[model samples]
Every structure is written in C-alpha cells, then in structure tokens.
Target chain A: MISQNSQTILNVQNLHANTQNTEILKGINLTVKSGEIHAIMGLNGSGKSTLAKVLAGHPDYEITQGSIQFDQQDLLALDSEERAQAGVFLAFQYPIEIPGVANSQFLRLAYNTIQSKRGNDELDPLEFDDFVREKMKLLEMNPDFLDRSVNEGFSGGEKKRNEILQMALLEPKLGVLDETDSGLDIDALKIVAKGVNHLSNEHNAMILITHYQRLLDHIVPDYVHVMESGRIIKTGGKELALELEKHGYDWLHDNLQNNAGATA
Target chain B: MNALANIDYLSSLLQTLSTQNPGDFPKDLLPENNFPWLKQLRTQAIDQAGQFKWPTTRDEEWRFTDISPLSTLTFKPAQPGNSPALADVSPFFIEEANNRLVFVDGFFTPELSNVNHKNQLVVGNLAELATSHSDVIEHHLGQHFKSQKNLFSALNTAFLKDCAVIIAPQNTVITQPVHILYIATQAETTHYPRCLVVGQTNSQATVIEDYIALQKPANSSYITNSVAEFSLAANAQIRHFRIQRENSSAFHLANCAVSLDYASRYQAVSVTLGASISRYNLDIGLRAEAAECIIDGLALISSDQLADTHTCIDHLQPNCVSHQQHKCIADEGAHAVFNGKIIVRPDAQRTDSSQSSRNLLLSNQAKIDAKPQLEIFADDVKCAHGATVGQLDNEEIFYLKSRGIPELTARNLLTYAFGAEILNRISIASLKHTLEQIVLNQTQHH
Candidate 1:
C-alpha cells in the first residue's frame, strides 16, 4: 500500500481517446499527487484541451485504450455528472449560457448534487444563500452577481471569476482549469489565480491547461509538461517553462524528431 | 332538414323588421339590393354553410375542441330587445368627451351613442353609413375582408344590416378610443356584431371592443359571430384591442382582418378570459414597402373551456416585416390551440419575420396544440418559427422554492414569467397594469 503522503490521487496510463473515429489523445500518461498544481502547455491541435475534457468524462470523447484511477477508484467507469459528484470539476473554456437560470441557483444545484451523493441533507435556500455569500466575499465578487442569469451577458472577466466561484462552492477533490486564462486581462488574471490558490488545499489538486507562459507567471505551477502530437514529450520544473519561453518550441520539436528517428 | 326549416322560419320573422318601409329604416341607409357583389357574396356564404358539416373531432383543426354543445343548439336570430334600457350598456365607457356605440341584441342604439365630432368619428349602423359615405364605403366596405373560404365571416357579411362603421380622416388623432359594447341578453339566440374601421394616411386611432353577457341568472346559452376590418394608409398607426368576458354558456367566433400600405403600422391584441368555446382568427396583409405589423395574443382557459387562435401574416412586398407571439395557459380540463403561419412571397426579399407559440399545461388533463409554420419563397429573407408545449420547469421551480418563497408562490412567479413576454409588448401603461393584475389573480387562485 502506498503511504498516505505519497499515494497518487489520479493516475492516467497511455490514454488513447477519439471523437467520431478521429484520434485526439494518443498514448498519454499522467500522474497527479494531492496538493500539487501541474501545468500542461501545448500548441493548438496538440490535444491539451482534449485531455482535460476526457478526464472529466465528456460524452463527446470515446476512450479507446486507457486506465484512469482517482483515489484508487475506476474513473472512466463513471458518467459525466457522476464523475462530477465524485469530486472531479472542469472549468469549461467556454461556459454554457443557460438563459433564465440564475448563477447562484446553478451553483446550489451542483453543490447539493455533491452533498446528496455523499448522503447529506440538502441545504435550504436561506442556508445556501448564507453559505454562497461567504464564498463570494472571499472571491471579492458582488453578492448581486449571484442573482443574474448564469453567464448570460457576462463579460469575459466576470465569466472566469464565476467559474472560480463555482469551484469554490463545489469544493471538488480534483479541478481541471481548461484555458481559464484565455481572454482575460492582467488584473483579471491575478484575481483568478488568487481565487484558485485560495481553493487548493492538502486534499485537493488542480491541473491548469494553457498555451501561454504568461499565465504561468501568476499561477506558478510546481511542474510543467510540454505536449506535442498528443504525447507529453518533456516534463520539468518551473525553470523549464522559462527555458521553453527563451528557446521557443522549435528546439523541443527538433529533439523529438531526432529521438523518434533513433527509436525507429 | 328540420333545422333548416326552423332557421327559415326565424329568418322570415327577422325580415319583417326590414319591411317597415325604407323611411322608417333611416333615410341614409344603403338599399340592400344596390350592392350586387355583396348580394352574391351573401348567397355564397349561406350556401357554403349549408355544404360543410358542423365542425367535429374528425376535422384536424377542431379535433381537440369538441363543438358538440354548439351543434346541438337551435339558435334563433336575436331581434332588438326592449327590456334593458340603452343607459345600461352605455355606462361601460367613460362619460367624457368622445364617441360611444352601444349595441343590444346586435342592433345599434343610436340614442345611447354619443359622437362628439361627426366628421372625425362615424358612429352609426353599417347600412346607414354605406349610403351616406358611398365613395369611402363602396371602395372599402367588403373590399378588404371577403368571406372567401371562411364560413363564419361569410355568414357575418350576409347578415350585415346592423354593424358599426367607424372612420377617421387623414392626420386626425382621436384622443379617446371609440368603444363598442355588445350585450347578449336572450337564451339560445345568435348575434352577429360587425365593425369596420378605416384610418386615412397619417392618421392615428384606437378602437376597443368589449363583449359582455348581461343577464340575471347568467346561464343563458348564446353564440356571437363578430368580424372587424381595418385599412391603414401610409404612415398611419392604429391600436385595436378586444376583450371577451362572456358567460360560460356562450360560444364566440371572431375575426380581425387588416391591410397596411407603405410605411404603415398596425397592432392587434386579443385577450380571451371567458366563454366555453371561443375562436379568434386574425389575418394581416402587408402590401407595400417598409410596412410593419404585430399580433400579440394571450388566452387564460380553465374548467373544461376551449380557446383557439389562428393567425396569418402575408408579406407581399419587399422590405416588409411582421412579428407574432402567442401564449396560452391551460388549467383543469381546458384545451388551447394556436396556429400561426407567416408567408414570404418571392418578391418579398429582405423580409424579416418571426413567430413563436408557447403553451403551459397546468394539469395532466390540460392539453395544447401549437403549430408555427413558415412558407418562404424568398432566399434572402430571415424567417424562423418555433412551437413548444411543456409544463413548468422543475429546476426553475426548485430554484424559486429555495428562496423561502412557498411552493405555490414560486409556481405563480414562474407562470407569470411564461405570460410576461406578450404582456410586456403592450404600449399602454394602464391596460398592461390591469392585465397584469388579472393574470396574477387568475394564476394565484388556480
């Protein structure tokens, strides 16, 4: 048995998934420990987003060959909402706009869904309101934002902040931030990073999927993984991100091509 | 054969009033035989009514709404009654400066009607105005609203003796809306109330028609066949509203036909709250460029009642637009029907039209039939139509319930949201407030 301090919270081995017969994530392996922040950086079409979506059990992606375990439980065996109740949260890159549904109301639903799955009594409106207001204050969000429609007519900054707000409310064990830094200004980036930092604890983990090293300046991940052609070609510490920024991805591409030629 | 003979006997009795010499029938009245086309049209109407069987469940349009009660009636044509004084019907309108037309048993009560400006407002019988204003009457009386295939409209044109005529001249804006109140008094009787409104170029006006049943016991069974026609010239604007609050034993068949020229606008609103069986047909024609029309309707039905609204907007010219939205809330064993068609012709390019019909069924027994159709021949136009029938949203209800609001209050709030889309379009403040109140009361108690 692995020690509690070093036990893996999530383990994905050679994950191969496809959507409509088109392979998206090919031969990927990842491991995340509790209380750690990992950043996955790749170019467009490199399947970084696809990996995040597959981890969350999105219906559009079919897992062809993969084994995912969360807390030693089978992760791929669960459905989307069930995966959600099992303490997996994905901050959507482009959050769905559900007209006529309030933001706070949606959060309460997600929170209650998790609670009920854990065999707990659902909080009534007053209790939920009190609970949500406290979390909103911690994020510096106006309490009135909870009454507005879910992501309807919300600005980019507000949408990203609301995503963090949801993460705070649900308090999931594993969170995937999918392109959360896209379309945000510098000030918004700091606020979002601060919220995310505040939510991470000894039992919870987060994976930040992005393309720019600029977002890394704020989140400051413990490790950075470089992905190319649906495979993690390199993994290093925070200084490796600075090295990639200075040398660009061309050096890594050349190294990968030489390595593949030698192996063939 | 027996029913035809009975109606024939009633027709002869009604014809006796026509024989009271042309002098007694008012000097300005149009001679019935002079309008050859109307004569032919009337005969066609009577013949068509005789050809088709009464609407039954076998017909697709009338499937959900059973007309058995209407078919079983042997309704005699209502004659002018003498018991209720004209003052009884005249009190429905304000006593301020304006015009009022009151009809009892389908006959115009001239003494009760007060026309402040005879030239601006023409408040008299249709036959009388046809003779006085022949040039205007000859060109428009039946020109816009022909019976064609509509049997009820044809029957209304055939018995067009005692209808109301209202005409506003060019650039004239009537401060007060002209009110026409029709009261049904006798049991097992039928009344056809027709009204014609013409707004010349650059004119603005409002017309309100209220149909109420006034009887002691209020259990009288009757049928009202009503038709209204409007013609708006360029830059003319008109607001027309109809409120039907008849007794539960009454059957109502109403039609509103409108025509708009270049750059003109017209709005037609119908509110159906009462009556056992009610049907409203609205047809709007935009014949020139930049013309706009809006038809907003709502129906609140309960207690085994049936309400049906059929609307059609024909875009015949380029750059013309029209919008239609209808909502129905059914409770108890009630059923509602909505059929909206928007047609864009080949020449009507750049036309923008949209239609939506939504129904909320409050009970398991309640049902709704919603059909929103678009027939577009123009390729460059933006035309879309949709229809949805469902119950209250469970998530919305749960959300509301979590806010300390009782389950019933939450239900009412969500229901109000369902009906708010159409009510918010009403431009008049007082009317909208009154409608909101009525809707709240109806939803809360139910």
Candidate 2:
C-alpha cells in the first residue's frame, strides 16, 4: 500500500467488471499516488488491459461491484469524456484511424476541450500548431504528421509516439499507458520512454501496463505490481519486475497458491 | 405520419386531374409562343408524360423513397412576385463565379445576375436562344436525355419557357465558372427551372447550377423540377456542379444529362442538403472513343427527409472510362437512396468503369438503400461496383469519447468525416468549404 500521507491520485477498491456477463476484473485493488510511477505486469488474459479500460470508463465493461476514486472524486460515476476532463488520460494500445479528419484539427479540438474544462484559455489553430510542434520534437515526429489523418496509415511505432505526443499536449493528472511499449522497437521505445519521462512530474502520476520488463529499464517505476486473475497478487519495489522477467509468472502463481494453502 | 410513409399523395392528385378528362396539356401551364418547333416539342412531351405513371415503391428504382406526400398535394404553376426581401446569398455565391445568372420562381432576375466578357461566351435565356440560335438549341435541347422514362424531366420540357443558356465557343478557355442560381419562392406551386450548356470543340468551361429557397414556406409546400443539359464537343472539357439547398418542405426533382464527343472530358458533382423529398437523375453518355466522365454526389438529410440519387453512364464507343462515388448521411428516420448503373456496349472494348455507394446511418431509425449495377457486353472491359450501408463504428465513437470529446461531438465529427470524404474531392475550394460547412451543420441534429 502507498503511504496515507501522500496525495493519492487514484484508489480502486475490490473493482469487479465484465463484458457480456463474462467477468474479467474479479477484484482489483490498487492505489496510485502523486509523484509515483507504477508498472503493472501480467501474462496474457490477466486483465491487465481490462483494468486500464475500466479506469477510463469504457462503456463496454459493466462494473458489477466496485468503487474508484480519482483526486477524491467518484471517478466511476463519471462518463468517459467526464473522466477525461477530470484529468484521467489513457494512451490506447491501438489508436483508431479517423479518415478525412486532419490530425492537427483533432488534436486541437481535444486540447481545447480539456483546456476549457480546466478553466484555461484554449489555443487557436496557429498557437496550437506552435505548441504541438514543440511537443512533437520531444518524440522526434515529422512535421508532416500533423497534416495526415488521425493515425491513418501510421506505422506501429509512429502510432505509439503519437499517443505519447497527445499525452504531452493533454498533460493529464493521472496518465495510463496501456501496452504502449508492446509494438515498439528499441529506438522507438527509448524515444517514447523519454517523452513519458519528460511529461512526468511530482504533481502527476502514471501507470504503465506492459507484459515485458524492457520498458521499465527506460521509464523506471517506484512500485511494481503483479496482476493475475484480475487482482494484484503481489507488490514490491522495481527489482520485482526484473525478477519476474527472469523467472516468469509461473513462480508467482506457485507462490500465490502455496501462500493461500498456508493461510487456509 | 411522416412524409415518406404517405408517398403517393401528390401523384394521386395528379392522377385525379388526368382522369377528369382534361386535355393532355394542362392549359394554364402551357406557354403561348410563336416558335412552332418549341410548341410542338412541349406538346409531344406532355403527351408522353401522361402516358407514363408516377413511380411508386413498387418500382425498383424508387423502392426506398415514398412520394405520396408530393403526389397528393395540389400545386399550381409558380408565378413571379416582387423579388421578396433577399436572403443572405453570400455563402451560395462563389467569388470565382464571374458570370452569375439568377432566377427567382423560375423567372430570370436580371438585377441579381452579372455576366462579364460577353464576347468570350454566349449567356442568355433558353427561350431567347430559340430565336437567336435556333439551329443549335433545336439540335441539342432534350435530344440526349430519354424523357420517356423520366416523368419530372418530361414535365420540365413541357413547360420550358425560361432557362439559362450558356454556349462556349471552339478552343476557348473560360477561367471563371458560369453560375446559374434558381431560387424558389412562394408555396403550393410547382416550378420548372431549366438550363442548357454547350461546350464547343476543344473548349474548357465550368458551370455551377444552384437551387435554393429564400425561406421555408409556411402552411404549404412547393416543388422545383429542374433539367440541365450539357453537350461537350470533341476534346472539350467541362466541370459542372449542381447544388440543391431548397427548403425542407419543398420537393425537388432534377435531371442532368451530359453528352460527350471524342476524347472529351466531363465531371459532374451534386451536393444535396435540403428538401423534404428530393430526387436527382444524372446521365452521362460517352459517344466517342477515349471520352472520360466522373460523377460524384453527397446527400445529407434528417428529420424524416428523403433524398434519392440515380445515375447512369453509357459507354457507346471503345476506350472510355467513368468513375462514380455517391455518399449519403441519414438521421432521425431520414431515408436516402443511391442507385448507379454502368452499361458497356459490345463495341466499347477496353472500357473502364467503377462505381461505389457508401452510406452512414446516424440513428437506428435512419435508413439507406444503395444499389450499384454494371452491365458489360464488351469482352475486354473492366468494371466494378460496390455498395455499403452502416452506422458509425461503436469502437471509433468510444475512441473519440475517450479523448475528451463528448459523445455527441464525437459522433458529429465522425459523421462530418464520413461526408467530407466526398466534399474534399471538389476541385473548387470555395464550393468545397461551403458544402463542408453545410454537412457539418447537418451533423449537429443527429
């Protein structure tokens, strides 16, 4: 558990969610605080991505029994856009292709929408172009990217970089990167990690959901949590990620079963 | 009941009138003129119009649109009134359109029109052309289009008293577009707005035909039946755009026919945004080898409005190419229909043609009917056609919402994107922007 004195950005208690009546997240309990970077690692079908989607208020999942608090507000009660405006940002693993809409226009609309919600003056197209270009430099994206359609025909690495670029512009209080490192090469992973690191601050928090420990090498996390069967089974320092990477999740499964037997 | 549900209303009224034993030519609608040839042409058209029945849902082409509301209405011929207070015409008037011909209530409005460089081209009334250029008008008018299968066109030709006529001479290049605007005013009246364009050999021209209403009429509905004919000579190039922005209560039917000579290039774009019940028929004929034609259309309708577009391209000679794409957006019980056909003659070998119809339904109640047909008799011809009808992908909607756009705004953006695909292809920048704004406005309601 994170310290009580620290400002908790997100708190999930016994969260249960499913789609089409098939339960995915059985009982997810986690706490993320400001200034902390948490890495959630799990094997396939372990509800890792589901946790991220559920946090973003995706309508596909039905929360049977749970409660989520973000910045001390009832996050679960808000819709997806409301949650987004409330400073909860999720960098999707698969960014959708929106044809016929310029990327710059989409980014400006999204930026202005969040800015207005924060009671800040929104930037127009010219100002936004200047601001977004500066951020694109951090990700080493080409200037032509702003002219193309949103994520249309973008390479996998380019899509990941685009997600991070959006995060840089949005500057949300709590950002969740779901499998952002899954499809990146080493070079793209470094650039993406650097972008995420540059955006991180003491006033904000981040949760990186990945299957590999490779991303942890670049964007180091303070806490590493292992999720299996929709629940966080173990929590440790960043060293745990390396150990899990070397030993695999089978060790943790055995350890979890043995501990349950001993307790029973 | 909604307008589309009672589809045969106006047709039934016309049927009643025809059964009452009145003469074939409705006396009040006929013109008293000196041109014997013109009078004979109208008489023949009226006789033909009475022989064919109004299309109903039973007809395969009109399966999705029900025109009962139009058929039941009792409408007289539209009469020109004191040019009513002008509605803002800035948006519809393109700056690049140097020569503009404005018609109000099917009558020419001289004060509202401006034609520059009179010596470069001939711009006059179609009726006047019967006297000034009778040989050309007699040879081209209503010759390319088969009016026996088209009732509205037959009605238009039968009452063709006034029309905007444009003639571009040989080897001339008109830099600016010739804009023909037909503004329908008054209610419970039918208007026949017509246009004839002739592009001579190796000439280049662009023509824009716009149909609009100053305001939505109260307590009554009007109808505008328009016919535009284009005759492009060998090696001539003509870019044509037709915009229909009538009042939602008005009924609009238009027929555009284009005849291309050897190696001529023709492009036609239609943007329909208004009218309660609207139908546009576009036909293009490639009479010589190497002729090319492109037809594109966009329709945005909601609130029980119904818009139908039917297009046909005939490949009469060898080595011709035609491409057609039509898009429709329907919401709130609105219905849209798109039917496209391509016919390749046996001698038209190596002819290339492709047609596509894409529709987006904004609501569960919104519906779209799309049919793309190809009939090829040439052994070496290549042709393909496709049609799709669907709603915005739920995943895409969710994706937008997750980025802080509200569901409604996200849906609007997606819908605009869907329609913008066609509008973005417009060669005229100002027209593209204006049409995009209209499509954006349509997205807000659904």
Candidate 3:
C-alpha cells in the first residue's frame, strides 16, 4: 500500500477522447499517487488503450473534453515529445519500426532530449555509452543490440525488452505500460517485470494495462481496476485480481448485464 | 527551347553524312531469301521513322529533357570498322565471359569476339544467324516487342542491320555470363544496334550489354539508337545488366522490352554514368500467372549531363507480382528524370505491385523530377507507388559526425546506405561487389 502522504502525480477528470470523429473514452476520472502500482484491465473493445494513448498525447487522438494534470501542471497542453520530456513515458503496444535509425542513436537522442528539457547537461556519446551499458546490464540485454536498427527485425519479446530499456534510460515520473506483457514468454515476462519493479521509486509511479490476470502474478499491482465498455466498473485491492481470475470475466459481465436489465 | 528547329542545321548534317564515303557497305544485309518477314518489318519501320518528326519540348515525354544536342549533330551511318585493339574497353567481368560478341561501328567482328563454351551457349550476329538459321530466327525474332509511338525505337528498327542473338537451351545454366560490347569509334556518326535474348524453359543465364566510345579526340557529335528484346519461357530466369559509358559529347537513346511466361522470372539492372544526353525506355510485360519481374537501376549524373529513365510494368495475368526501384544522384548542374508507371488490367486480380523512386541532390543547381504512378483496375489487388526528392537528412548526418566521423565520410556513408537496399537484392556476388566499388568511387570523387 502507498503511504497516505504520497503526493498525487496524475489527476484525470471527466476525460473524453476521440479519433477522427468517433469517441472512444466517454468520461473518465482517475487519480494516481506517486510510488503506487496500478493495473487497468478490460476487454478487447474497451477504452483502456485509448486512455493510455490520450495520456501520451498521440496526435491522432483528440481530447474533446476535460483536463489532465501531471505533477501539478497541465499535461494536455504538451505535445507528444514534450510530454515525454516532462517525465511521462508510454510503452507502445505495437512499437514502430523506424528503419535506418540505429537503436543506440535513437536512445541517446531521446535521453538527451528529456535531459535537456530538465536543464541538465547532455551526455556525450562516450558518457552515454557507459550509462546505457550499465542500464542494459541491469536488464540482462546484450550490448551488441545497440548497433542494430530500431526494432527492424526484433522478436516480440526483444521489442518489449527494448521498450523497458528506454523506460530505464528516461526514468520518467509516470510510466504507462500498455499491454507490454501481451506477447512475452515466461522468462521474458519475468525479466520485464523485474525491470519495472526495479525502476519504481518514491518519486515515480507506474500504470500497467493488461487483459490477462497472469501478468499480475509477477508484477503484483497494489491497486486493480476493472473497466467495461468505456468506464471502470470496479476498483479494489490485490485480492480482487485473484477473485476475477478464479471466476473469470464472464461472471462479472453477466452480473453487469443483469443489473442493467433490472434497472431498466 | 526549340533550339534545334533551324532547317540549315538539318541540311548540313545530311550533307556531311552523304559526302563522307566511308566504304562500300552490304546493301542486302537482311536477306529476303530467309526470314522475309524481317525485311518487311524493316521497311515498315523505316517508313514510320521517315514520317514522324523529331520530338521537341512540346511532347509530354520530352518535356523535362532537352534533345537539342542530338538533333544538331551531323550523324552519318557508320560502316564496319576495325575492332578496338584494347581489351580494357569492356565491362568488369569480360575476360571470364562464356561468350563475347563485339560490334564496331554497328558491324559484328567475329575474330575479336570469343565464344569459348560451344554447345552450352549460342552467340552470333542477328543478321547472319537469320540467314543460316532461318527457321529459328523467323519463329522467335521480333515476336515479343513491337515498335511503339517512340521515334527512337522506330529508327532503331528501321536500320536493324546489325545485332547479337543469344539462345540457351532448356535445363542448361551457363557458368559464365555472355558479354555484348558495342563500341563507337568516330563522331558525327549514327549506329543502330539491337540484341535479342531467348532463355528456354528451365534455363538460366546473365547478359551484360556494355556501350563504350573508344576514341576521345573526335570533336563531332555522335548518336546511338539501340533496342534489346528479352523473352523468358516458363520457369526460366534471366539477369540483364546494361552499363552505358559513352563519350561526354555523345547522344544515346535505348529501348528494352521483356516478356515473361508462366512462373518465369526477369530482372533488369541499368547503371548510367556517361553521355551528355541519355534516355532509357524499359517495359516488362507479365503475360502469365505466377510470373515475377523486378527492375532495379541507378544513375550518377554530373557536370551538365542529363539522364532520364522511363519504365512501365504491365500485369496482364492474375497472381503476378512486380517491384521496381530506381535511385539517382545528381550534382553540379546535372539533371535527372524518372517516370515509372504500373498498370493492372481488370482481369489481373491478386496482383501485388510496388514502385519507388528516390533522388539525392548534392548541389543547389542540380535538379531532379521523379514521378511514380499506379493504375489499378482490379479491386482485390494491392498497389502502391511513392517518390521522394530531398537533400540528405541533417539530423542523421549530425549524429554520425558527432561520433568522430568526418562530415564528408558521414555524407558518403549515408548516401551508400540509401542505395544499399537495392544493391542487396542482387543475387550475383561478384556483380554486387563491383557495383559497390563503383558507387563508392563515384561518391568520393563528387
């Protein structure tokens, strides 16, 4: 459990987002305190990924209403790269493969972009080499990978690992992992979970969006939220995940349908 | 500008060609005794060329490239001259060639040519072979490609007196490539050269057509009108390479057409590095299902030179695939043009086609015009086309420079990477290596 004195790092109120002209997220209100691990679970068509993308300021998704606050500042006012510089990182569900851009070069550019935004001196290539080497050691990644093109031919597990590596290098205050464990194997899941666990600190927080309860067995979220349709239907402690795993989402889905029928 | 519209220039050019009595040439070069159809074809082509006027900028195809230098030249029909004594006027892989056919001033020289592998490869002049092997020549010659609306092709077919023909039998894979060398020795001269390659079912072969100018001291202008036709039978494969390195004062216009049968594969690779004004017309027709065609080419233009390539790939059968990629590097007042079109007929369903053209400009005065077009009539097909013309990426170059690489080396490395994608598709190791070296040398010199 997070301490009561932990400051709130993210405040989202009545948020609504859309792509083109179709609305995905209706009205979402959520508050995330620092140093806490939260998991958002939902079905395939629900707005879980939408919320993650909206928070990251993806250009395609427009916010129709409401406001998002990050660390006492307006988060919606920032662009995608600016949000990245402001200590907010979103692990893409499907990472883009940018050919001709080397992995090491991309990481260094991203790192310097964020660091310079914070008024920190940028590290030279040699300095960055040393810094990333240490971080890669922690994640158990091979150093030779730095020379390859960014995600050009990487396997699903390797791509997820590379995302975590970027997260480690940036050290953002709020890291949103959008379905990072979807395609990972057992060993890969353990390594990714360990990387996330080691990066979480008193000044940072994480929100894991997943569809399966199998991932929670390793990541061990402090808070769990069940989302249906376009909003969260239930919020509880860790045992709630175990309860849902035992009975399955169909029970809760049927219960919700019956409740709606009764109310009507 | 219609700079060559002066009637005086045309009259003077005709006079110069008629006055210079080179020697007695064979009037009955294409005999009517055998392959009489070829004689009729030549007469029709000459009539067509005579009726059509020289195109200027008013024509859509010649809008970007100017052919005034070609029209102003007094070009005479070249007769058979002595073979070039130097062997170095050949391509990179000439000595190891299984068969070499040398043509000097539009006439075949059998003594200087080498046909080392007897039964595996068949190489000889097209006119001579048409007389000796009339049955085979009449059946296969001029069966695939026809004279289009292009004037250069009409003229080439009109004077189609000298050409080379190569035939590989079924299931025979020649170990060494066949080389076709066409050397122009005199200026103020015109040469019409044609080559026909027929790969039988299950046969595989590579052919390199090299165009070179032997004498550099000639002050007059020259014109080379050429055509090459390739036919690939079912399950056969052919790799065709064209290397054009003519004189700086020369004008070269070439047309290449290929037809592929069921399950056949055809690849055309062109490297243009010489000539003051050059134009290449390439067309590939996928006539049967499951056929594949790839067109890969590159041009390095510099010093007031103009290079243009126009290609078209037609998918007439279902389940066929075609891919084309061309790159141009222009610098120092040079100009380059690329126009590629891919068309899929209504009955050609499940066709997967893609075309891309990329240009890199090194100087502010250099110019490039690239257009990639696609016309799809089938709804179930996948088609895409794209063209990009821009300077080098500043951020990428800066990143490399910061890593201790000099600015020039970084730029060269990035440019090499841009062209490496197409080079990687070459299956021949030695050819690929030679091309890489040429690209490196060109970039460094620029």
The candidate maximizing DockQ is 2
Q: TM-scores of the models, in the given order?
A: 0.63, 0.82, 0.65
For model 2, chain A alone compared with the true chain A gives a TM-score of: 0.96
DockQ of every candidate:
0.04, 0.56, 0.04
lDDT of 3 by residue, B213-245 (tens): 876465346788888889889988998878887
Clash count, candidate 2: 10
lDDT string, candidate 2, A17-54, tens digits: 99998999999999899989999999989999999999
Poorly placed runs, candidate 1 (over 4 Å): A1-264, B1-53, B60-63, B82-98, B110-114, B118-124
lDDT-best of 1 and 3: 3
How would you class the docking of model 3? incorrect
Off by over 4 Å in 3: A1-264, B1-23, B26-35, B94-96, B147-149, B218-221
By lDDT, rank the candidates, best first.
2, 3, 1
Candidate 1 chain B lDDT trough over 10 residues, lowest sum:
B397-406
Interface RMSD of each: 9.1, 0.9, 9.4
* Model 1 agreement with the true structure over A54-153: per-residue lDDT tens digits: 8877667899997999888899997666677778888878765544456776677667767887788899889999999998876678888887767778
**lDDT tens digits by residue: candidate 3, A3-51:** 7779999999988888989988888888899989999988898899888
Chain A only, candidate 1, TM-score: 0.94
